[model samples]
Target: MKPFRRRSLLAAGFSAILSVQHVLAIQLDLQSTDSIKAAAKTLAGDMVSYYTGYRPGDVPGNLPSPYYWWEAGAMFGALVDYWYFTGDDTYNAITTQALLHQVGPDKDFMPPNQTKTEGNDDQAFWAMAALSAAENKFPDPPEDQPQWLALAQAVFNTQAARWDTTSCGGGLKWQIFAFNTGYNYKNTISNGCFFNMASRLAVYTGNQTYADWAVRMWDWCSAIGLRDAQYNFFDGSDDNLNCSQLDHIQWTYNAGTFLVGAANMYNFTGGSQEWADRLNGIIGNLKLFLKNNVVYEQACEPVGTCNVDQRSFKAYLARWMAATAVKAPFTYSLLKPILEASATAAAAVCTGGVNGTSCGLKWTEGTFDGSIGVGEQMSALEVIQSNLIDIVSGPVSQDSGGTSKGDPNAGTSSDIGPSDLNVGEVTTADKAGAAILTVLLIFFVAGGAWWMVT
Candidate 1:
């Protein structure tokens, strides 16, 4: 960056533009990340400030009124990541408040006594967030504050009692109530989230029982075609009770939960090629959440419409996909470019409201069409936050054909996966200059979205 080197970058041909582009790219990346960082902090603040409350349906950044258990749980998961990425205390405070209100007298998260909606899957979502907070060492509020790990454990215990082997070779049913629509359905979200939670708990507590459960869940899910050979995750099997039919609809969160579990299994015990392959396979199909390589909900988007749960799905996918990078660094090279490409696309879609900054469901980069809400805000916040993780972890190489050796201390990781909820610094490989540049150009085009918001 000396004067001569700077001038040398500015020659008059296509070569010159390409030569100087790298220099410009550096400034642009910093701007983009800065914008992302600032936006994550502010939007998170806005969500908590405006939407969440003592009522059942009040969690900000969730779709559908009167509070849905899983959606609120999903929002808390993102809040946990925001805490780790930026050390923002507000997210922590809100999370504590939300949990305090939601965790009922029995320590099950009933949420304002909305017991009818308390599916095991819905309840486990809260536990997953608490486990994440516990892993990160988020301070307990007071002695009065529920212990995070204890809350998560309680959730697991609740699910364990419901495991029915009588049908479909054993998977947790979607609903706790026998008469509910999904009651007989052994769905992927319930089983998948349980798999992820079991994997984390196996590492955290060094309990073979938890590890065994993780293994069991993985086997059942794979055998049932919920987590299939193609790495294409299907929605849960319907309530025919036979488990022979698969729903086949895919969601961002399904991949998120299953891949994170696979990555955790790889990290915790090592030499699980099956697990390693599963992780790679899912990473390969991440375009399920992307459009032209930029991440999208893939279910309801570009039409600028998404249903209650679908609107909030991408945040979990983005959050845990970043986690997968940490849990299996060997895959870092594979994950980085896709994530950066998507983040850059996300930055572009956020525009033309709130000081030229509005978040919309459609990620296909055009000016924002004036639709804005909590779910849109969070979808943008989570993706941008992952981009920040990319910058910190630095350049990553795709892990090639070599077998995964895993962590040297797989035994220790088996007991305590990762460092306090950290993704750890992913090692760099050869830089993907073009990919990074593509990201920067999109951010440059959408530069005002970030800058004008503040």
Candidate 2:
């Protein structure tokens, strides 16, 4: 009877262990790719509706006027890429319509007044790339293709005309607004965007001028961006009073854009160790900024006292980090642990419910409910779903046929079923772990107190 009881106990323990392992291994299919595609489609549909029927100067979702240019440009690029990868004609049609709306008579650009800034030139890059790609894909070009290309060319020409070598070590001014403000500071974000756009433009149009601009811009940024002693980079301009350096001296987006810009330049100009070194430096600083299992901005200090505003920036940081992890060399190994942690955290939060609808981490309490106006869903989506994994895993080199071995959906989770446990239960587990640690510390303190008293 005693032997039988022991055997039963052992069997129960083994079963418990197996159950735990099963939970750990269970990857919830968030339908991430599908979700991203759906979101992109929804956004594109909104753009089409706004452009075709809405009142003049009307915008979607009450977004500020300054953001419209970049937002539309980015959405256009994303939709274009989605269409390219999935061959979804719906996305293609919407992008074409949206681009056509911006094209005008005599093939001159009629950029909505809202998008007039040269700083907003990055949007044109994305827009042009998508439109040019669409024209290439469909041999029967749209009537508006020439108009669109001409518009893009004009915008590029205007921006290139503004590039002055007199100030800030020979780079483009940050923006027209900055120029007006007398804030003619050279910035990493602007220069990086310049490099990215120029490189892509060079590739698409086969213009060595674009390629030259990209290389010159990248070389300028790399030389000025890095801080040798700290092994980090700044956002540009040494004016510490510029609010660009609030707390942490390092930022994920700055690092990410620079790294990506470098990678894109390398793609066009062939590989360079200088670019590789710059990318690695950004990655190194970013890795150092990760603390308490969370990526924080190193540019901000007194980490614990930092305001909740850090949440939004951190989301951007995560997205950039994930992106960098996938794109930069020798960085994937470092990214795996962080990605797994983020995935696990997201899964833990998303567990339970019939359709698993409530599992997402809300940046704030009322953003989704239309209260308090504190939501930015796209940032969350960008961080969670964008192909950062591809950067880390590295893409298979394409042969002459333009085929590569990297599968975007490879190793993705297929299980989308609801979890047996609720989010409350997950919260309880976290609280319980914290409580245990607190009690242990208290006990140690009490023991020390007693010894001193004796």
Q: lDDT score, residue 105, model 2?
A: 29
Query: What is the lDDT for 89 in model 1?
Result: 76
Those runs of model 1 whose alpha carbons end farther than 4 Å from true positions after fitting are 1-33, 54-67, 302-305, 352-355, 390-454
> Candidate 1 lDDT, tens digit per residue, 264-355?
88877863787788788998888767777677777667555577668778778877777788878888788767667766666566653434
lDDT of 1: 0.67
- Candidates' RMSD to native: 16.5, 20.4
lDDT of 2 by residue, 1-454 (tens): 6999999999999787655544432143334655444433432343333232122333221234324444455445444444543345775654554444433222323332322243534444444444334332422224424433344455555445556555445665554433223235555555565665565455445567777887787666545543343445565663333323322245555555555555555555555676666666666666655554444345442333333233234444554455445445455676656644543343333322222222223322211221111112223334444433442223222222222122222112321111311123225675567667645743554344233222
CA shift of 31, model 2, Å: 10
Q: Weakest 10 consecutive residues, lDDT, candidate 1?
A: 413-422
Task: Please give the CA lDDT of all the candidate structures.
Answer: 0.67, 0.44
Models 1 onward score TM values of 0.75, 0.56
